[model samples]
Target: MPGQENMTDVTVIRGNVYERLSHVIDPEIGRSVTDLGMIVAIDVAPSHSTEGVRAPGRFDVTVHVELTVPGCPLTQTIQDRIDEAVASYPGLELVPHIEVGAMDADKLTGLVSSLKAERRENPFNKPGIKTRIFAIASGKGGVGKSSVSANLAATFSALGYDTAAIDADIYGFSLPGLFGVHSQPTNLNGMLMPVTAWGVKLISIGMFAGADRAILWRGPRLQRSLEQFLSDVWWGQPDVLLLDLAPGTGDMAISVAQALPNAELVVVTTPQPSASDVAVRSGLVALQVPLKVRGVVENMSYFDHAGERLRIFGEGGGTRVSDRLTDALGYDVPLLASLPLEPDIREVGESGRPAVLDSDGSLADTPLASSFTALARRLIG
Candidate 1:
């Protein structure tokens, strides 16, 4: 009688197993393996009644998983998640047996085709999309615009926002080096997957090799590069998108405004007067386009030494920029933050990590980290 009930339970579990596994998403594709036709077969049978092998009425679930390609980088991770899902089935003792294989050429092609058809156009361009786009700009180079973009992206991700960044500084891209992403993106058909590092999805020209770079860099114009990044890649509608724009107030800013009409500008400047003057001009570009000037960030504003806050780069450059922009644009542009000029900022950044974030991708407790966290919150709010 007990064995008969166990059989009924197993019958119900067959459908339940597939439902449970549907939640396991492939990190690269951002879709469930079950939806992608990766789970080829799931055979469920009664476990042997042998002593000490498994509890009575237990079932052995053998799951056949077919990957999109052989030698996939995340093969082990996918296998482990499948095992956990089966082994921890609720109210039953389920022993999981997973078989891994690659999808046949025809099946793989069909899957890729289905995805491309479903996502034919840029998801962000659609109406009523809730993604907040931030364009980091500076009037001139050496004002630490890229550093602010990188750290701000890291901070947004660490705070649990789905974040993505574009190294729009195409001619002088540095996000690949800053994020330390040496590996190439996974190319599924013509759509490329962004490399996730420090919890932020990133795409940069530096990540591509000779031929691959050339294909993406077709047309050799600033606006074209930004268009390719937006349309060609599978961005999956991130909650926050940050762009590290090229310095000196012209083509790139106009391109971003034209492309992303809702984008807000965040100006970065130093405490020095030379940098502040240029920085104000950078934010003033908002007047020409429909872009909103969000706020200003002052980098290299001070140096902390032996319990003393030293104004190494002079003071009030951030306020000056913000005040000038407010008067010119007739809108109050506030000074969001003033970051310190610590040696670790450069050293850690060069080592391929955002200094405001810890090694484990959490916000650090230092002043710099706090500054970024606050700035991110204010910008989003």
Candidate 2:
């Protein structure tokens, strides 16, 4: 019965290893390693002392993994995940030896083909998609729309939600600069992996420079670029997706509505009649399209100076836009947030990080972060 018991033990251990690995998700693909055909083989063997005696309750596990891409930037992350999963096995001392390599041409081709087939067309446009699509738009420029989008996205990510953002403003793209993402997305067999910055997955034309940037702007229509961003890029399934649309009432908002039928529009405006006047027009696009006007955000509503909340940009602009849009659209378009005119929003943001996020990437404990967190929760609800 000793031989049979030994076989049984090994079988149970192998099964347990597989179970642990099932929870290890690929950072980019958002699928388990087991599901992605990454786990080529799992070999479990009992450990032996130098004297050739079997060590009880101890084993050596060799996992042969074939990554989808060669020399993936996140290879170390995957390795760390696998190591943790193996080393933390319950009630046993297991040493993991991971054998990492890239999928060969044929294997990679099959994987990509399978993934593309499963993805089909734009995944977000499909019915019953769980992703909450928020298109952040503003009637005019300099309203900190991009800044709001970046901070909101960062807040969502810090709050433990999977978040992604698209800089839908192709001509005046600023997300790449705000998030401080300088590297282009990894192109794997025509599929682009969004650059992860400030805990948010982001894609923007600004990520491309020189000729590539020019090419995106040259011949294709605005709608076409938006379509490519939706269809061509692999977004996986983020809990929230924010699109920082170009300022002014333009085709981008309409394009978003046409492309993403489930998108909700959040208008950004300063606390002044001039900005709020146009901000109302941005939300009014909901009438032209079937999109819903989510709410309004008043950026730079005040400046905190010497125990006084100074109305630097005036007031009631967000309320005015909200009331106007609510009256026009026949729904409650409440003002979601009134962000302050904090200098860090621009200075620190220009340094390539969301001002709402502290250096550690967590939401800061400032009033700004608190307002954004509340705004994020409200939008989700």
Q: All models: lDDT? A: 0.86, 0.90
Pairing residues by index, what is the TM-score of model 2?
0.93
Q: How would you encode candidate 2's per-residue C-alpha lDDT over 1-381 as one tens digit per residue?
A: 767887888899999999899999988888999998899999998999999999999999999999988878889999999999999999999999999988888887787788889898788978789999999999989999999999999999999999999999887889988999888887878888889998899999888757244433433488888888888788898999999998877777778888998999999999989999999999998989999999999999999899998998789999999999999999899999998888999999999999999999998989899989999999999
Write the residue-wise lDDT of candidate 1 on 305-332 in tens digits: 9989899889999999999999999988
Q: On a 0 to 100 scale, what is the lDDT of residue 323 in model 2?
A: 93
Steric overlap count per candidate? 0, 0
Best by TM-score: 2
Steric clash pairs (candidate 1): none
Q: Give the poorly placed runs of model 1, Cα more than 4 Å off.
A: 1-7, 49-57, 211-220
**What's each prediction's TM-score?**
0.91, 0.93
- For lDDT, the strongest prediction is 2
